[model samples]
Target: MKPPSSQGLRLTCLLLALASLCLPIPLWKDRDSLMQEEKAQETGGNLVLSRQEQQLNTKLVSLKKMEIATAMTTGQFPPSMHFFRAKRLIDQSKVFNIIKLMPKGAVLHLHDYAMLSVGWLVYNATYLPDCYICFTHTGTVRFRFSKPHPPHPVPAQCSQWVLLESYRKQLHNVSEFDRSLVRNLTLVTDAPEQAYPSQTFIWKRFEEVFLIASGLICYAPVFKAYFYQGLLEFYEDNVQYVEIRAILPTVYELDGTQHNKSWSVAIYQEVTRQFVKEHPDFLGAKIIFTAHRMLNVSQIKEAIVTAMALRAQFPDTLAGFDLVGDEDEGHSLWDLKDALTIPYSLGVNLPYFFHAGETGSLLQGLLLVLHGHFHLGAVLTSHPLQQQNFSAIILHFKVKQCLSQPQVLTADTHQSN
Candidate 1:
């Protein structure tokens, strides 16, 4: 059988070549569009939808349109309006109610420090023993959990620290006092336009609120409770998993025993382990160890190295690294390329989840995409915030994605609706 005649072999080969020519070649011209369709499927486009699911999706589309029409006519729940301002209006939307009822998989982009409510902080942390409170030169509030004696230096912003427990008892209406504290620590207001006149002002106050809240959270006992409570809140929201971005605050004891960065990372692992053991349905959480974007390249590089070391020690909990801050005010991705490229140069597979293109300029966002091409990592772009070129970023950089704009980092309600 193997010893067929050369003539017969030639005839068979010729026949096969002719069949191949007629079979079909890929249409290279449609490659771009075809790839895009596949991309859509990868990003929740649901190409293989069942008939029932498609019908439900169509109904959802109609509901969206109906809601949009009502919103346009009533000027209610405007997308441009602040979320806090329009929260009541959102409550009235049937679509929003339906969405709220749906179980969420994960909160991809959360700042662990700001995950819980100001009310939660008031009741949990403020009620703890040895807690002290004071007011700044301006009307902003301050908190600390150290002894009320002269040893631990008081912040100049807080003139005199009074025991929070005693202060609460002095008030006729403790609830009202706690409510005032909540207002002091949050951006919630009857009029956001008057309170937060400019973007700069809002961010400034946003930073201030974190500083105010940090005092209670930095306390050792409170730190542990805060982390557990944060996980619990996400669990209640039907979020089985979370990937948090945090600056890893210095946790201190009432006796002034402060822990290091490594200790903080360990506690995160410990708390998460305890949480998962109790509630197995909640998959778990990861921390994208973060450095402030405003830090120098050298500082950030140091941070990256520290993150690499920490990730080595706590591989499961330390998810990766990221640069976090208000994009408009902090160092741009281009400016930090030296530091950002370190992971690539060192041949480390530590994935970056940098909060890029979070600024309000599309041009700036696109420019950030150019610098980010040097590093193989994801850019957490704030959508339509000068970040309209996400497709361009993904296509060019071959990036992964998640919506992690660090909203929970502060009360940045002005931009949301």
Candidate 2:
């Protein structure tokens, strides 16, 4: 098919303009009002707005009244009108005042490290030792020092990890594969199955980045800055509560002052308490302890034991457990089911959020226990060839079992209704 001629495009634009004017007086009036405002600004005179401007302003007020009516009646604005009014409100610089009137909720899937703003990282480094950073031969920018100085300099570099001045400016250079890396490592993707063909390959790369960043983030004083950064990001997003999945305990000091789960929990709690005190809107935080599948039975047990202990100390703050690391090369939660059972029994009250049925598993007796939970019947469907329903079924079974009877929030008449 040939492209439309220039005359055809001109006619289409005119028709669309006429159609818009005929449909809504507010649309045409709002545009006319904007033109008048531009003219007034250019002329440097305080001339009264035209009838169109008055009509547009009146329409805006009417829309605001309708917003309140709809929200009161249905608990939310109509989807179409909501976006239109919201855009106008924000453009008028009243978004914050408007949002402050609404009740906000919790933010999920916030990674603690990336939340740190560059401003905080640089500003705080001036007062802390080991905040000095340099580019290593490997080209990865990391914090380490012979003396205390400014935070990692703007546009500084390390092996392959360079801090760009602007994320948007550098975004164009990031390829689709790199974008996938960012999403997988950062927990930005919702449905990993549709996002990736093999969790085994994706997670292998994920663990490698964690290993690399661990050493880079462990420098003294970075933890404090990191915590604050995460808090600030949550604040900026209008989140009242945050349940960040932090892997802080995985990082260690240069002299081997290995930060354990306990230390990480202490740091997290301290920061959370201080932040909530300063910012009353800031509610609370919880932890999701993640263990590497590459760990041996003993190591896995120790990790779970640490998680259990933390849960005991901070019952409300510590949420649950997760398994991370290379899925293909290492033993999965299934392989360590017997070893994990002891901890599960001991921490029976603690919740479990296992990552199950992701990439490359044997089908032979797959019916056997998956991470100590048996798979029941699957919801079979048509068109088996094109769909990954077989894989999704197992994941569904894992989620079902994980959220089953034991922690089903049983109602108790023992307490007042």
Candidate 3:
């Protein structure tokens, strides 16, 4: 499949913000209105530079000064504005376009299910052989595959399945149906503020979309295509390598044959191998195997053991383990510490790469960082990821966050910065 457009790549900023642009201190916008320092602080101002890098730095510094002056004159606050609003103007940004051309080393933490465009999933995946679609009673959609004519059981929540290709034929305006399906697969909407009433409501809707997309992506053929598509998108964005936070989803073939998580892990490795072979510049990708955080101690331990076994087989492919879900509602690091210590008791050397502090719990935030010291040391996300939301807006993330407001995080945003 062809890679997504630059506009789709711009959404890549949200993942980077949620994954990396965080610190214990609240992220501050450096607009003249917010701060008035004679000399600005850059992360590596003291570093020695090569001639080429120095030239690039001089040019970038001039551009930065010009942007700050522009914002000061217009008082538009492009870089300091919320990215939800800033994104509408990102295409015209020189800084973002240049960053897109620069090589980014690694994406240490990004959800496997969310790296690509829903438009791709809607138009591409549904056209495959034996694919069927059904609407759940609660109005969510699901996809599955079976022999073209088989007596198969439908999900208990859903109505009977309609072959997607045939269903498209029955539609007078297939484009409208496809658009609706895209909306079902993603939280994108014109009135996201109206769509997401509360944090709990929004999180629930987010999980529902995850479930819907998993049905399509977890099918065997689509799994390979989707993984490769994600890789292609990152490669196009000049990201050299990635570390995907993946669930060991149960993939099923058209013949109703179910494959375990090991099959899924192997496929990830195969896709990465194929991508690196095609694009030798790519340093290759790794999977940080994850499980739901809401699971009990027994279930969490089983997941760790599962990760250990997979890592022994695919040492490079299966990178580590983590528990993924809503941190506020799910069991915290303290609650799951006993289970997290399983790798050590067995001396299995499994590492962790967990995402935390998206919600506003000071205790949870401390536990997540402290959990690293407790065992299986991990890193934190405190670096600036250059994204298209205007250059100044990169520092607009709110780090000392409590439960996030819909407006600040963006109504459709997956998580807080």
Candidate 4:
């Protein structure tokens, strides 16, 4: 082959440069532009809105704009603030009144012990005839319903369990005592962020409060009424249906007679049924039996067995089972895989509603859903990592035939902060 001349090489290079200029260049979007595009795509798909729907959406947008404007102008806390701070401002601004009137489809993630007001638990539940309380050395308060008497002599456990009635009598004003009790039972404070420095600190207090309430709520007589009152509270907030997560610990009667797990479940069913019957407008309530994540494998297995039995007895009202505790400190869902799979292996229909990734690890949550095969339900915290991983998991699993059935995926926004 003959080599090209210098002029021929120059001509070739010039032609290549001209060809490059004619070729189309690919365009790349920045992060902000991509996000905006995604947002538009999401909103643009539902362009054909009904007249009523359009009016409602317009009203909502206008209200939100007004709220933001007011917050900015007055230098008040805005709706965009942390939930606790925003809630405080909302309460003071009376904005919560509007929210209260709005119809909530279903409240699905409330812890049963924390649903009712602390004031009601202290003033009403603890004010019962035979209620007693003991303050532990660790600053945790425990309540019990026993026969009306003086403090019990249990020096080994603690000094004694004092009758709430006696304390009420000793106090100059019972209302003040009730208020103090409310403080012990709730996380409500002027500065919650300061009081609870971290999630660990707050969750410790949260668990302690539950323990305090459990002693009173686990009493057989109070169990039924307390559940009913909780339903009523949700009803007042325009929540028609609820699924409450409860430990379902063995309950005790006022006479100190202990009731088995089955009895406690029966009580739950009865109370829920009666409440629904009376308040016909309310859809109904279901119990999601929860086991502590801190429990050993054997304990978890036992809890699963009991939950399965309860489901058999009350299939209609027993929604499902869940593992509840601070996800960061407790055992992961994988640790109790055998126990979790028992219901499936036994041909029972109990579904899993495991709390995963509440601590901030999306990878941990993804493993819980994928490896555990929790196709029925999964509760995840709304951290950015979790959200991204969740979206990936959905896309990853959506095509699998085994996961074809509709699954419940709930995000716990409460822990996002």
- Which candidate comes out best when scored by TM-score? 3
> Over the stretch 194-221, how does candidate 1's per-residue lDDT look in tens digits?
7777667777877888889998888888
Write model 4 residue lDDT over 270-296, tens digit each, in one string: 888899899999988878889998998
Every model's TM-score: 0.75, 0.48, 0.76, 0.75
lDDT of each candidate versus the true structure? 0.73, 0.53, 0.73, 0.70
Please list all clashing residue pairs in model 2, or write none if there are none: 138-159, 139-158, 139-159, 140-158, 140-159, 141-157, 141-158
lDDT of 4 at 121: 79
For candidate 2, report its TM-score: 0.48
By TM-score, the candidates rank as 3, 4, 1, 2
Off by over 4 Å in 1: 1-75, 78-80, 147-151, 360-417
Segments in model 3 whose C-alpha atoms lie over 4 Å from true places: 1-42, 48-85, 360-374, 377-417
How many clashing residue pairs appear in each of the predictions shown?
2, 7, 2, 0
In candidate 4, stretches whose alpha carbon ends up further than 4 angstroms from where it belongs are 1-56, 79-84, 92-95, 137-140, 148-159, 360-417
